[model samples]
Target: MASNIPKFRFLTAAQVRRLHGTLIANAQPTQPALLESAVQSPLNIKYYNNEQNLFQLAASLPEKIMKNHAYQDGNKRTALVAADMFLKINGYKLQETPLQTGNVSQDLENAHVAVCTNAWTAEELGRFYEQSAKAIEEWTPEILAYRNEATEY
Candidate 1:
């Protein structure tokens, strides 16, 4: 039997950043394209409709849209930005991503796909749009602190 769970791979902050930037750039043509391509694209719209599906797809590191770096210094930001745009285009409202400061850990072995070391997993990125979602609601402030502490290492 094959497992449906995507394998989790630890990534450097740079790698994650690159991934984020790529996704946003790839889907740049449409305003809120996540809705159109993800919802009305000629292929696989149903899967994009559910939260789990979005998580599975986002967690899958090998996805083309998830790995195409189109900008400097903001891959993860870009990915979330693109995801937000996609969702909005498809009729979903999302909150803006918080400010990011460089300071991720050099220890990539334990890294998870979160907005930052203290945020939720990249798979949970949709929570930003979910009603009453609190995972990353105030995480930017903590992340800023984390960045400060990280610089000393």
Candidate 2:
């Protein structure tokens, strides 16, 4: 039943902005309508569309946030962290993606660029997220410390 599907913790539009400030740059929004809608999309999906996979639900953050170009700049960077934060809040992390030459980060970056260019659809990115997802316990020192410190936002 759809009711049995777990409700995942979501980032607020406020949090998305906070993240944009923290990760991308410290700035105020002159026009925030699109950013707000992007951040809230997952909630709409959970309650109305009923996605069951946490990773797939998490994928919506970066997808919409980037696609909408939620910020004046660094929309790509913000979209990445926003999605990662969503996963972290709900007890997950994306595993290190593999690459042929062995530098996984490049592979992930390529995916982001492809998405930005519309070469890959949101569903493709969603699958990338789902396939890479791992429990927090499974993570090592971690991709970086951005999500480590606590904040009021």
Candidate 3:
């Protein structure tokens, strides 16, 4: 059965670059090859005629982007933000708090290793995404308020 949820807007390479510029100091401009892959990744997922589900798309996004090295620097950061935005637009959010623990960089590094080494299969990654995220409707007012405040700054 198809989900009742509306399809979310996936990020374009330009939007990803804009996000990187906004968030990272001295961010490197996106290369053409990088931009192409970054733009194509989600479209490929969206249009795939296979058995992949939405969770798989969401799970594959970060891994693909991070592994592609779509940016000269901060590829992992860009990947994380892009994945989060994708999930948020789709009414979900990553539950891990690597940022709160000041381990985002480390987390990304581990994610890279896992992706490259096939430590987690695509289905497994999808399960991991499911495990790490929850519906936006479940967010507490305090968490929502904090998210709002954080976005504002």
Give me the runs in candidate 2 sitting further than 4 Å from their true place. 1-3, 95-102, 138-153
lDDT tens per residue, model 3, 1-153: 976544545655666676567665356655757655765666676666443466777667677777777677777666666666666656677644432334544554465457657786656766766766677776556344334432110
lDDT of 3: 0.61
TM-score (C-alpha, index-matched) for candidate 2: 0.77
- Across 11-110, the per-residue lDDT of candidate 1 in tens digits comes to 2234333334454333332233332232222123223443334333333331223334333444445545433333322233234432233322121112
Q: Candidate 3 — number of clashing residue pairs?
A: 0
| lDDT by residue for model 2 (100-121), tens | 2343455556777788888987
Instruction: Give Cα-based local distance difference scores for all models.
Output: 0.34, 0.69, 0.61
Per-candidate TM equals 0.31, 0.77, 0.68
> What order do candidates take by TM-score, descending?
2, 3, 1
Determine which window of 10 residues in candidate 3 has minimal summed lDDT: 144-153
Candidate 1 TM-score versus the reference: 0.31
**For every candidate structure, what is the RMSD over all alpha carbons to the true structure, in angstroms?**
14.8, 5.2, 6.1
